[model samples]
Target: MDSTATGMRTHEIFIDGVRQVFHVAGTGPVCVAHSGGPGIAWEYLRVPSLEQRLTMVYLEPVGTGNSGRLDDPRDYRLDAYARFLHGVVEHLGAEKVFLLGHSHGGFVAQRYALDHPDRVAGLILFATSPVTGEEFWNSAMAEVARFPERHPGRPEAAGMPDAFQEALAAGTDEDYTTALRRILPLYFADYWAHEELAPMRAGLLAWIDPMRGEEPAPFDVRDALASIAIPTLAITGAHDFICGPRWSRMLHEGIPGSRLIVLPGSGHMCHLEEPEAFTLAVADFTRASVPGAR
Candidate 1:
């Protein structure tokens, strides 16, 4: 493992023949977490404050970031992803670790907790949905429609879904990369425009290669949420049109003892759009769940 300038130690670990890279930093109880997209890397979700207080394990899901591709696209289901997370925690020898997931990653974290509640110390879900229903997709499309007028060269934002589907059907590496770069801004209008993290974007684009030839596992967690008894935190951004406050509200209501925090003016990528508020919310919840973590 090698250390980064930000005081984090990074390592490459393998699970089920798929290579995964993770960055571990700070002290205290472990916080095993991953990013969204079902394929997005951890780079976009990096938060310095969370790392300062907890041993944050930022994971790169198989076929994403520095992680190696899985030979079988069938290995990318939610159940498999949950097992992969469990393996990572076991690999680190952490008896109980706080779990955090953003966007789609929240779905993965929640499922893992349900399958192995004993392994988790706490749960943190950000801008996630309970189920992938028609209402959710319609709401997401509405949000995408509002961006074209404001974003230059994206006069056809409303047609993103069809365009995306077409690209997936016959896209080369460069084509997929272009599609991702185009769609990413819709997730976080502010960060994509302002954050100077060019490498992160490039890495995300590169990660798309493994993401292809795989379908996103259908998201369903009603039964799973009933099994989760750990202290949980659900965060949403008021402006997040993709997975709006309604989604987080459903999660908070369904999960027993879960607290909900909705940040104002923030969108899908709430952590990046409003880092201070996001960190404070997560930090406060972490302190409450873990003994002496404050």
Candidate 2:
């Protein structure tokens, strides 16, 4: 399977009996992108400009899109996602590929690189953190609390907290989807000002079970981040309430010699909020990290 096999298309491959679905677009170096939410549809992570610089593999992720779901919903953890990602990379026949993960997807990327360094040419930890425990939750809520201060009298500001709580408490797919739309604007630096993104908000889909699954331990890989020797880039939107600069900086500090880029004008969804700047950073990093890739 050479690079040409990646020509704008959608491919499906079975991994451990589970069908994994992914879409291929653009040309150049192969870069596999995993969207956030553990449950969010992968479509939102697509960046057409970046596709111009690299062959983008947008994974639908098992249990999310056309892919198969696990019999036990609790099995939807980082390790499972990483395994499916590895299968996609192997099926592509790319000896080495750049892995880009956004938000929760970033967590999957980090776990993959740390577990399989030889298979990865570089890493892009976009709008994600290395840990997710009490500290992480507290810091995120703190940021949410400040939303009203930034927006002043905006009516949406009043419901932001409740919206976030609803997101966490969402018991069904429909409940989660509703909660997501209500807080979708909060993911952008200035979503209301960008009416063009309304359709994205309207079409969002997610699963409530994955997020509510039981974890043997709180997700924390800070101590192991230093072991990742491949060229790495950690980027996020400055205004990102959850995985903002503080979290990205920890990624930078923990991953030795990694590059950090904070898009000041964006929020959690930096790629959508600032595609040009996001593309430039990712494009340059991939070109430099994987020599002769283009």
Candidate 3:
């Protein structure tokens, strides 16, 4: 962390009586990053390469990390997260800041940008979709079924089926974390080939807030995507089984003037799997999209 800029610091603010925690590092134009999971820890989404060129604020979204949780887990929804994100951006003192969201985080980002377009300088929707229904679930399931064929001879491949089921049924923090570790390989284009990601898998942390019998409202933003007027970039990995090109293309086509980038050799975790390319795409987009950004 460079001392000349925001450097490295953890800041906490109270949003509607709930504690909101965020980590700031690197320098240059501010780009607030929201991690996915609606439950996974925020650390997994940190992009060191992009951080070098932009002041990165990694948000520990409500119900995750040191941030305060909602009394009713059912209150955890995209609109709610987007509101909390707005509070964080306001607290950062930036009238407008570039926003980057990954996976579930991308959903929140879309909602936020749509709800508060004036406060956003630019939007980066990475590895996310515009809708979630039978079509989305079916596509992912079909890909999950092919995991074994993709990683032939790997013993862990056999456990993916069970891992996917466990992840869905996980009700406790420990179980959720364990399930995430088991299914994490599926998020990468070639996890076995890259041993560097092992530490991340081992250190993975998550919290599960079950809806308690109630299902979340089906996520569908296709009809409303055209309303987003901010500069947008929809990037994803070609190999990302979940939220791959098929979904990113929809985001690109829906958001008028939005750019798209598909990392050819990566998967869901494009930032980590293809750091150099990922950093370049995001950093360049930030500079081009945000006026007066360093």
Q: At residue 24, what lDDT does model 3 achieve? A: 91
Tens digit of lDDT per residue, candidate 1, span 135-216?
7777786666666654556454655556655545544556666666656656664444555545656666534534432336
lDDT of 3: 0.88
Q: What is the C-alpha lDDT of each candidate?
A: 0.76, 0.88, 0.88
Poorly placed runs, candidate 1 (over 4 Å): 149-170, 189-203, 206-217
Model 1, total clashes: 0
Error of 1 at 31 (Å): 0.7
- What pairs collide in candidate 3? none
Deviation from native of the Cα of residue 186 in model 3, angstroms: 0.7
Q: Per-residue alpha-carbon lDDT of model 3 for 1-294, expressed as tens digits?
A: 133453568888999999999999888888999998768899889887887888999999888889998987778777778889999998989889999999888988988888889989899999999888789989998999898899898999988977898898887888889889989999989899889999999999988755521236678889999988899999999999889999999999999999999999999999889999999999889888766756
In order of listing, the candidates' clash counts read: 0, 0, 0
Cα deviation at 58, candidate 3, in Å, is 0.4
Off by over 4 Å in 2: 1-7, 211-214, 292-294
Tens digit of per-residue lDDT, candidate 2, span 203-283 = 988876564533578789999988989999999999999999999999999999999999999999888888889999998
